[model samples]
Target: DKRIVDWTNAQNEWKRREIVLKYIASKGDEHELYALILDNRFVHHHRSVTQVRMDLNIAERTFNRMQEKALWEAARIIPANVLVEK
Candidate 1:
């Protein structure tokens, strides 16, 4: 039962990550969107939000807004179980 639970957790995590990445990739030519992914460490190596802000040359408020928007978009696009293959 423990093993099954662990496996289920792993699968869920993978699915969540996949959905977020797909959402990010769908937004074409939005540097802020891509930068949010990098800042959040969704892909590639992780970096501090401060570093991401500096690298993207965006202010703190802007970075926070972008992060919030990216998360909102990902949440909006995540499919209900009825729409996903078992």
Candidate 2:
């Protein structure tokens, strides 16, 4: 427990989102794409899937694939114990 870094305030989802951004940024070249999609979908929560696809000029299928990849990577970054299922 002492080793795990948990600076995010659980009551404030935005803090967790910031941690997610930092973790994603620490990744490789793919981080940009992952960051963009994840930021819009989860971090910012202002852009819809269609808006992202339009902004990127990618087809729905491609967007879906990228979104899936982003989610998978984000899932790996966050600790399992910290995540609560509804």
Candidate 3:
């Protein structure tokens, strides 16, 4: 079923990767983190890009740009502005 293989799955996969990246980053495992990201099952995998781009509702370039922006935001070094008084 081609319809079943459309943007919905791609979007879901992308969201899953978004969370997974955050989770891995939290774990602080430098060695396995790269491998997990590169694994084919993850949406960010090298081979999945074509299908993800074509199937997603957004344009390929837009999606790529958004992903890059998200990575930058996640990696920003600034600490939280609001400090707890306790």
Q: Rank the candidates by lDDT, best first.
A: 2, 1, 3
**Candidate 1 residue-wise lDDT, 1-86, digit = tens:** 99999899778866676656666776776744653554355445577788777877879998878777776666566556413443
- lDDT of candidates 1 onward, in order: 0.65, 0.78, 0.49
Cα lDDT of model 2 by residue, 1-86, tens digit = 63343433544566776788778977877787788888887666768999988997879999999899888888887777655577
Q: Which regions of candidate 1 fall more than 4 Å away from where they truly are?
A: 31-47, 80-86
Measured by TM-score, the strongest candidate is 2
Deviation (Å) of 17 in candidate 1: 2.1
lDDT of 3: 0.49
Candidate 2 Cα RMSD after full superposition onto the native fold (Å):
6.1
TM-score of each: 0.58, 0.72, 0.33
- Give the C-alpha miss distance for residue 58 in model 3, angstroms: 34
What is candidate 3's TM-score against the reference?
0.33
Candidate 1, backbone clash total: 0
Single out the weakest 10-residue window by summed lDDT for candidate 2: 2-11
Pairs with steric clashes in candidate 3: none
lDDT measured at residue 12 in model 1 versus the true structure, 0 to 100: 81
RMSD of 1: 5.6
lDDT of 3 by residue, 1-64 (tens): 8887877776765665565456545655542333243333234556565665564454768756
Total backbone collisions, model 2: 0
